[model samples]
Target: MEQLHQQSILFAVGINHKTAPVEIREQIFVHEDEIPALLTELRKTLVEAVVLSTCNRTEIYGVTTRTDLDLDFYKDLLINFKGAETFVSREHFFASVSCAACQQLFQVATSLDSKIVGDTQILGQLRDAYAVAKRHEATGKILNQLHQRAFKIGKQARTETRLHKGAVSISLAAVELAAEIFGSLTGKTVLVIGAGETARMTAECLIQRRVGKILITNRTRSNADELLESLKKSNNFAGETIALNELKNHLNEADIIISSTSSPAPVLEKTDFDRQTNKILLIDIAVPRDIAPEVAECKNVLLKNIDDLHSIVDRNSRRRMADLPLVKRIIMKEMSNFLVWYYSLPLLPTVLQCGAKPDKEIQSEIVRVKEFLLANVSHVHKLAMQNGAENFAGHVEVVNTLVAMKNAALTLRLEIEA
Candidate 1:
């Protein structure tokens, strides 16, 4: 138990918009299908792990006992996994250990660290990421506790603070940009290129603006129809579903085109809009970009990609900055609670080893045990920092011991309370 005190390190490693450009982020993005295999590989080194790969960032959160597995090791794993060794370097990555790592995750879950600080989408993203990890058996007691706590903290932050008072998601930012371009959305016709969450959100925003009409086109007509039907239930706006191939025919009629498809390649080429003479605003919010870059060169076409929405995001973030302190306090309080529980884990085995005794003797022993465990835990932390990767072969054994102790302590306490 003493040996395991500081050896089970919780860590977060990866790159975000602040550390890496969108191009690098897209290259590192782990698709849903790739997560299981990636987690399998990570299990060789990590005791517990979760991979969160969104459009704006990709991060790996894990509990590892091996001191040898530093920040560089995780960065190299990502680089090798993505086959991005040629371009991606260690500089694009960032890592935090133990308490710092825990704080980072809390901030992310509460949307404090998002590209748009008050964005409401990150909480659901974190929830989905944790669900995937849990479903795959990639998480253990530590991660299970951490993520569940995060969800509670996230909800608390949103409910108690004004962090989400006027939340502006990426999709909303896109719609705002469209409004800015056209001066008004009252008579504007929007052509939505997909029926996913982003596309739906954008449509909803546009509907609120009283946009004249919304034309939805998708690779799958059923998905497009589903979105159209949902929107119809909410609003009486003229919503129409068009075939994917009919996109070109409607190009001239659409004043603002918002494309957020998951297609691997560009769905709209310059040639598709070459015959268009009417001015059109095209916003491509997809990671791979639904519209070809060359379309920007076409006549009467104004193209904007995801990066173009930064101006609007930045402005919205500033307005939300005043609520940050409130969210920060919530995060700090939650983080402190988590760290207290985490540090107490190693003491579980020692406390259980005390065996049964008279109430008076047990009370006195508890005081002495607390002092002893604190000193030993502090010493272990110092040694971990000083030794780094040296003598780390016993990492697995340390994790196993700590986990067993934690589970046993929990069961015993539950039985006692009952």
Candidate 2:
């Protein structure tokens, strides 16, 4: 029954790398455990919705019929959802609606809005969030169409462009930062904390840099072991995997530390730097941050977050800019196609019924005219009536074709509004 009632408003709200730094973004990071409650809370507002929260962005796409609920109302709710007091004022928020929001979502889905351009990982993250929303039954026809089209567009961008062929990642940028700090990683002992995607990618890049010793520490010992095992087959590096409980003991021993752990709070504080004697580069690539901000004050420790990696990723951004026109063309084309299809939907059944109510009235008129001609006219007038009837049928056929074409175009325009 709800599906039968069309929604008048399509809205999206959130913050992302473009709007917030890693520090502020982390404050709003929704944990998996809290998602269900969030969905329930949103459902009570009578807004059909889907939430996509990733390390880079937190966006809610919803459809509502209530014209009274402005975007600011939902923005306040979103801010509250993540605890507004935690995020700094005058920073860390962005929102868009209708066409702009749809465009932004398409850009996000294609990874064009990612911290790293053409990031393949974000596609998976988007899918994960979509799946979670689907399991929660928060999506309806509008979101379903939008997300599926976004996925298709994302795939098209990847397949059709050279956007994903180079070192465009936070991890690789971290490695570059280490190389800038240390000059060379050839003889360095690199410690990669956490066996997640970021950590593993950083580890790979470090190995590629020909680091002497590699140490992997993860909350789970088995994950650390798995990382080491995978690294062993790649190249001969003297490395070992250890449990996270022993992370602090080994911190001072390493020249470089790249952390990508999923800890909700700061895991590596200033206490970890108590016995440090040498200069150590610490790259905090995790959201909510694995390393404490205070640790940067220590003479030997250098702290860098995902935001700090942006300037370094600017080179990739410049290269990606060249392909923007082509991507925009693709988007415009898809949008036009979707609009045309949408605008033609309501017209389809009416067109199939040969004008429905209007056609019935015309039919009645024809019947009346035929009866009038038969009862009131002579045989000589019957010939003229036949000619008139043929002319009328011809005119009607022409009008029908013209109306159908007009309706199809109108349908396309309607889709554009949607």
Candidate 3:
């Protein structure tokens, strides 16, 4: 790793699917409403922070005042805030700082860190995380820029390479499992539960397989009808819509069931399919899980949940890893551009100097400004003059120059003189 000239304040820390099992990852997974509260607690210590909680990872992309921000602070925060202390340990915690941290964020936003390596869902997930932080005032100039760069890189990575062109997400993985079980779905009937994005994706996958029929069921019949209209195939396609109240009647009729609803509890139980003697595959892709675990115990009914989809996700991710080098090339380019803008900020040097206290050495001038002044500061006055006037940021140029000059002889003052 190149020795980053900037303060090692940027940090990426948390347990992800790579370090922990799916059980633990889901245990700590944060909901949308919990973001404000989590970020509230995080900003208490971290200078700028974003909590990026996804199905595959729960990570904190943060910037702190001090370079030596204890990694335990993140773990303890999760323990106290999300009750994750018992579910995981230090072994599950992974961390990166400075340039490495930037690289991780870029890669994750670009889906390089995903279970489905090139899955684009992460881009939206990252955006939502940034939006939450921005909403809570948890993010500042540094994190704002970092996340924006990540968004740009994510789009560019997809455009410049085949990263997401053939990417398989969790929903698609469920369809893959279906294909493996039933040699071909050309003549099979698929029952889709829910009118949400996941269910729509599953139906699309089934369509690609040339499924003979599709039955959509939703709490609102109108939603099911809307989904049916979208899934309708031209030239003698068979599709139908029904209310959730009618779900039980169709269970035995479907060869495959893909359920991804927002219900708090299991929508389908073992008793719902007691009469199902023919081999049927039920895939519940919901997070809280739309289908009961006992459904798998029903004779001739094979149940697959969100966790089971990961095996296929892992296999597809490995295949997609072939495109990682190309994706990384894009991330590195973006990282370089971000660093250029970051190091040129004059006040950033002041902030770092204030945060990083001088250690046990000679307490000399070189120790104070050599790394701090030259590395992160350039002539802000020079840039301001080109812009025709001294702007607010440019005003800092004089203050910065005076401080550096003073530090050339004496220790940096603990506080600016009154």
* lDDT of every predicted structure (CA atoms): 0.80, 0.70, 0.73
lDDT of 1 by residue, 283-401 (tens): 98876668888899999999998788888988888887887888888887787667556655544445433344437665654554454434445443443334422223333343454
Order the candidates by TM-score, highest first — what do you get? 1, 2, 3
Clashing pairs in 3: none
Off by over 4 Å in 2: 1-8, 86-91, 233-235, 341-418
TM-score on alpha carbons, each prediction: 0.83, 0.78, 0.74
- State the weakest 10-residue window (summed lDDT) of model 2: 1-10
Cα lDDT for residue 314, candidate 3: 70
lDDT of 2 by residue, 82-176 (tens): 67665644346565544445567788878878888877777777787778878989887667777888888888888887777673677888898
Instruction: Indicate which candidate wins on lDDT.
Output: 1
Work out how many backbone clashes candidate 1 has. Answer: 0
Q: Give the per-residue lDDT of model 3 (tens digit) for 3-95.
A: 223342567788786898766666677777787888888887788999998667889988765533476767767866767677767677777
